[model samples]
Target: MHKPRILVVDDEPQIHRFLGPALNAAGYEPVRADSGREALAEIARKPPEAVVLDLGLPDLDGQEVLKRARDFYEGPVVILSARDREIEKIEALDAGADDYVEKPFRVGELLARLRVVMRRQQRQQEEPPPVVHAGDLVIDLPRRLVTRAGEALRLSPKEYDLLAKLAEADGKVLTHKELLVSIWGPAHAHDMQYLRVFIGQLRQKIEADPAAPKLILTQPGIGYRFMADEALRPSGA
Candidate 1:
């Protein structure tokens, strides 16, 4: 089997230095691009299985890089940036990134996220089951429908997609970018505001208490998780 190819786009040499060995050790072929222009060139020449993009590219804004990347690359694009502001993170995710890593991140965590992306991609290539469930919420993939507590719940196209994706992972946490790409297409992956609004709407329709949700749970400053019904047991029995 061919090793998974990864394109690492960043203006900083340090990032390449830090990530190259890690990726190589993890059995992936790493291709480096020092600027957004170079990144585009690399992508046009040959698209990789995944892209690790930096938001602080010299030639163009990382978000613009993301936009251009979508024209050619269909795989996951994870943003690696120094920006820690919530708004900036939200913007990048909405712009099309599949995940975000703040600067000074742990290599182990980054690799783990990469693995998650790879696994999700692989799952997409295989035959998928018709229905997905989490607690009282059940999604019928063939019918494009959702039901909670034995009652049908109307969900918008995007909302349904989001819920289905989350249900597929069960108790796993999904970053904003991951949800955006899975549901809204790569071009809108960085549009976190849109996700927030839709999630709120979804909660109103599905959750018993949107304020203190029981199913769709938030991981502040990280992402969201769809808690498995079995995992919500009372503390200490």
Candidate 2:
């Protein structure tokens, strides 16, 4: 039986030294790429189930790798970076990575994150989600269609994806990290600005008053949640 494959894109020899055995011991096949261009070529040639990417690539920047990877690779991309700046994390997540791992991370922690992502991916494939409804809003997830007040609404791909994820977990507060990583990818999870921009756009289209949004409630310092009832928005929501 073939073990699940993982592509590790990092310039550091120590990263490979550390992760190679960890991945192998965890029952995964580890592949290595030392630069962004090499990572891209490897992905195109034989896609791995997941990607471990370092943001500072010598040839191509990590963000460019993610931008190009999004074209053909839909799998999870966990970013590895020593730069702990929030903006950096936001940029990577928005670019299309699945998770972000700060440098000097514990091997156990990295493995745990890998398992979480793999499990989420597997569960998603195993179950078919139900159509979503929130008063005037209607979302047919599988068809990638949405309508509000009995009228179809035009939305960009990213907008629709964000809405769908919100609708999928109706009434649940989706953290900024969760929504960003799930919709935009891990690299972008910290980019709350992108979330704000998209959420504002969504409210304008779906709410009777964009100024006073009811369907999509802001959790304040948390994330956003989709209220199933248009009229039952939480107090001060």
Candidate 3:
């Protein structure tokens, strides 16, 4: 299977070293560009699914690179810079950045953000299914029904909602804050313990072996994602 390609544009060798394996583990093929000119060249050669860009470049400013890429490339660009000033973020967003994360970012969080931005772009181009089937697990969104190997599973309202949300995410990581706000509302946005309990409950019901779950994957401190990949589906499914 061809993993989604992500362009990592940064002058720092350390950044490239850190992100390359992380991107690969998160199901992305990392393409490297150490300078602004090289980054532009790579994009022109073959635009990637998304880009992780740094503001400081040896050849040209990162903003200038973004502006130039925006002229023709429509892929999402995420600013991954050391610049933490509010004005820098505003300028980057105004210049067409899909998202921004500062240096010393958590790898899990950065991966989650990348998934979110890329998923947003994908949603703009396609419609999601109301039904999700991963192996023996089937989720019927409209009917709010879930089953394992054709046996109907009983789930609480919150469990069903959480499963539905993750299934709809299509393998993208749904950040803890995003999931909490959507399900438990803003009032319970910081309730990580509460979320973990529910996740544990859901896993027990859905996973063949709850201790070694395969259906619903965890992103450590970030959140959860359903393991729904095209490669895992039946042929022509």
lDDT of 2 at 108: 78
Kindly give the stretch of ten consecutive residues in candidate 3 with the minimal lDDT sum. 228-237
Evaluated at residue 81, the lDDT of candidate 3 is 65
* Cα TM-score per model: 0.66, 0.59, 0.58
Q: State each model's CA lDDT, in order.
A: 0.77, 0.79, 0.81
Q: Where's the lowest-lDDT run of ten residues in candidate 1?
A: 228-237
Which numbered prediction scores highest in lDDT against the true structure?
3
Between candidates 1 and 2, the one scoring higher on TM-score is 1
Encode model 1's per-residue lDDT on 39-144: one tens digit a residue: 9998999989899988887889888989988887778887786745656566666665666667778788777667766665666678655776666887788888
Pick the TM-score winner: 1
Q: What is the C-alpha lDDT profile of model 2 across 31-121, one tens digit per residue? A: 9999999999999999998999888899998889999999998888888877445556666765766566678787877776677566546
Please report how far candidate 3 places residue 35 from its true position, in Å. 6.6
Model 3 clash pairs are none
Residue ranges of candidate 3 with Cα displaced over 4 Å: 1-7, 13-49, 54-124, 229-237
20-124 per-residue lDDT for model 3 (tens digits) = 999998889999999999999999999999999998899999999999999989988888766445456556765777766777777886787787678768875
Query: 151, model 2: CA deviation in Å?
Result: 34
**Model 2 TM-score?**
0.59
Candidate 3 CA-lDDT value: 0.81
